[model samples]
Target: LKDALIGMDLVIIPAGVPHKHGLTKDDLFNINVGIVKTLCEAIAKCCPKAIVNVLSNPVNSTVLITAEVFKRVGTYDPKRLLGVTMLDVVRANMFVAEVLGVDLRYVDVPIIGGHVGITILPLLSQIKPPCSFTLKRSEYPSSTILTS
Candidate 1:
């Protein structure tokens, strides 16, 4: 890890088992959490100023854990830490665009909350063309706001 990270400007950690093969994000808490923590520790020691982008599962939880690890090493900077969920954003945009029958490029969605299926928040409230959509509640469900 040290050798790979030397002089690196950005460190993106998508380290974790995925929800494939029925392995849910929660199922990876033990191993993935430790991997994330250890990597963050090394990053704090080796490259204290690098931007750490964590693209792990259970983002809401892993992010907090990563922050805690950084704080423990006295290198905690909210600005330097980021959670990468581009896939989530893409998924939401595509889904919403399909629902609205518009070009996917024209659909913009802001997904918040957690990283799991139920925890994802799709901010559909503010969508393009100022349309209205009813949403069922779920765990940390995503909300989408249209920007058209």
Candidate 2:
């Protein structure tokens, strides 16, 4: 794998057990952490300067773990390490847009923080065409109502 990744410009690490196994992203802490650690080690050895974008389960925790591994190996670079949560952002955008009755394509929501159900922080405050959220008749509440 080192030879295959050699000279790579960007490495996206989304390696881990998927949801079909009844595992939440956070449930991956034990195995995925080590998986990421090993991969990042290889990346450091083969392409130390390459930008590493982590898209694995438990992204929040995995990202932090990646940083730590890189740091330990003296190859840590914040700018080169990224946690890709675009799927989370897209989910929030589509969900929010559905509530707003807007076209999903035009909707943009910035989902930040952890990727788990409770920890996922979808910031509507930064949404474009700034919109507000109204409560659904359902018991589950939108975290916050953002209006523009």
Candidate 3:
């Protein structure tokens, strides 16, 4: 692992137990956290300067675990550790495009916050091409009602 990582500029950590039927994100934490800890240990030893993009499930927690591991090894760089939330953005783009009857390529929606269920927030007001959608109060809760 050390030999292969030498001089690498980017290391994307997507290793985790596969999400399947009956398995919640929380269910994955135990397995994925161990995997992330082991991999991060190798990364710290081999390429401490590499940019680490973690795509592991339960990312909100795994990211912190990675940071703790790095800090313990004296290689923590907050700026270099990133928790990828691109999946949420992609889903928002697809859903918005479907609703607006536009090509997916033309749709752009910025999804902020963590990558989990309610934590994934689509910035509807900032959507490209300027569109609006009506939602029932019961169906779509107000942003103020949702918590991280």
The number of the candidate with the highest lDDT is 3
lDDT of each: 0.76, 0.77, 0.81
Which tens-of-lDDT digit does each residue in 38-115 have in candidate 2?
999899889888999999867778899889988988999999999987777777776677677789889888866677
lDDT of candidate model 1 versus the reference: 0.76
Compared with the true structure, the alpha-carbon lDDT of candidate 3 equals 0.81
Query: Which segments of candidate 2 are over 4 A away from where they belong?
Result: 24-27, 136-148
In model 1, how large is the Cα lDDT of residue 96? 73
**How much lDDT does candidate 2 score?**
0.77
Which regions in candidate 3 have their CA more than 4 angstroms from the true location? Answer: 136-148
Kindly report which residue pairs in candidate 2 clash with one another: none
Model 3 over residues 64-148: C-alpha lDDT tens digits? 9999999999999999999986766777776777667799998888877876667677888988969887874214433322232
Residues 4-25, model 1: lDDT tens digits: 8777778999987765676654
